[model samples]
Target: MIRLPENTTVFDDGEAVARAAAGHLRTLCEDAPNQRFAVCLSGGSTPKRLYTLLARPDYATLPWSRLHWFFGDDRAVPWDDPLSNVRMVREAFGTPSPIPETHLHPIPTADGPEAGARRYEATLKAFYGAETLDPARPLFDLVLLGLGEDGHIASLFPGKAALDETRAWAAAVPEAGMTPFVPRVTLTYPVLASARSVLFLVSGAGKQDPLARLSQGEDLPVGRIGGSPLWFVDRAAAGA
Candidate 1:
């Protein structure tokens, strides 16, 4: 419920953001050296730099073999489409992504939206079936998210029914309001709030207005995620 530039790390540029991300990854893996990192990755230009950095050899120092990667949200596009978050991650990572297939959880975009969402749910259940962990917690130790210009996080756009969804930690987005109308796959509010930590990676001049509105509790999707979330922003994005 509080926003403080001093609380979260602020990077001046994309390079700095990448370094911070790599450093965070290193620290997280250090604590659980033998355990897999159940991380949820964000998609967007803001995180593209981090993705490339992580896929590199230096960033690959982590026990990639034991890393588990999951997407926080995905567009309802075919697997090969440029908009596919899965493909973007696969492409960003060089030869060895350090993550094994058993750990990579990409949405089933190929089968179409409805089926894709259903299949992804099964995937999640299969992974944490007996853990007794709620749909949101522990799915990811750290969830990296990006704030949309409209204050939307993941596929939970402003005023969309998805924001009101309470059934599962993850849900299928079938509202045709979104331009593409492709089924979007995303983690629900409970799951988001359940995460051990949530980091909002926001860096862009176009985001100032929305960020201002969110700060005022304008009832945006991004505003709903109010558990003292950590934010990463550039000077320009902050309009400071």
Candidate 2:
């Protein structure tokens, strides 16, 4: 059987999970010594709650100005498209927030999936100041992730070509495994691995099967992620 990480936390529901994640993020930002922090954001209902919570007045003390936001992946669609992760994040974070325009780094989709992936990779390398990722100096201070029903993470579907990527920091997913079916631009495992902390936020009763399979050591996309992630799941998703 696969061993669960020691930091796994189960809450009563999705809302509770989001609240706990927000608290953890607040602490992470507050205790960080870095003059500037980089955060990789995930796209999902539960994560939207966390983003909304962070934008509220209660988290006003969070160092938003110094914190740079990056997307783990985005659909190859217009930024304003209803299915776009960028749109979801923008709506969740709300306007008139402390996050500066430059701090929010979105995956560019106008040039199509392949071009977008290349551009995003260059953007990350520029921010990291290196073409190669160094384990000693991680690229992101925190990476927030979500578990898909199909056991995917950051558009990295099981058995997809993106999973085999070792050199490129980003890749183009021509066809997604599930709904929306749009091509995607996603950060590869090598890039995601260079994170100080990774957290998986999983909820919904539909997620129980995947979580159970993971517990049984069934190989899946999310399992391949590099960092030792802390799973924050709801009771339903935890099968509790």
Candidate 3:
């Protein structure tokens, strides 16, 4: 497990988080060749700021067409529902909208959570194309995530079946203790560990305790990553 430094830059408010994502995305875009710069995103309030920041001119200059968006997880709710991650991302992409729906690879949540996860996993395989996502040799370019107050990332909540999943990279597991939505789609740790780069967006005082615990090597889902997780923390969330 890798440990985060005590004095990482604090995005003053959410601005810091936004700038961090923008810069990293611009760099990633520049690095990839003609192929798509595939990025799997977390569904949470944390990334909303980053997505909004990308709408600006500086961030907007990325090769949007050569980019593909995938979700780290999603509620079983309909796309139009308030609990929809798809809605959040599309809404965040206002104005010129960086990419079209053709580029957005949302998991099929409309097909009920369980079925949606299955369909989405198939889509993921297609996205990887020739590279193929193998649990033994995972190699995602970038996997962006958000820190849940309860230490969850993606749909891999504490004690969620997916947490113990060592087989499938993407799967649907029973959702209990979860709010209203039923089963959800998620990317397992084995797949996450294979990523070349992992970026986390954390904000709010509500997240500080988890951040502290995570930094102390707590066995939280987001902390047990096989690869490094570069956290973009905000001032209030980092604690004094």
Best by TM-score: 2
Report the candidate with higher lDDT, 1 versus 2. 2
In model 1, the Cα lDDT at residue 54 comes to: 80
TM-scores for all candidates: the values are 0.89, 0.96, 0.89
Counting clashing residue pairs in each candidate, in order, gives 2, 0, 1
| Model 3 lDDT per residue over 1-240, tens place | 223444356677767787878788777777776866777777777688778777778765688877778888887778877778888988887856878669888878777767886787677777666335565544566788877778888888877777888767677866733565466777778766666578888778888877878778778877666655677888878874
Per-model C-alpha lDDT, please? 0.74, 0.90, 0.74
Q: Any residue pairs clashing in model 2, and if so which?
A: none
Name the runs in model 3 displaced over 4 angstroms: 1-8, 130-139, 176-182
- Runs in model 1 lying further than 4 Å from the true structure: 1-6, 135-137, 176-181
Q: Which portions of model 2 show Cα errors greater than 4 Å?
A: 1-5
* lDDT for residue 192 in candidate 3, whole number 0-100: 64
lDDT of 1 by residue, 162-187 (tens): 78887665777776334556678887
Q: For candidate 1, which ten residues in a row score worst on lDDT?
A: 1-10
The full ranking of all candidates by TM-score, starting with the best, is: 2, 1, 3
Give me candidate 3's TM-score against the actual structure.
Answer: 0.89
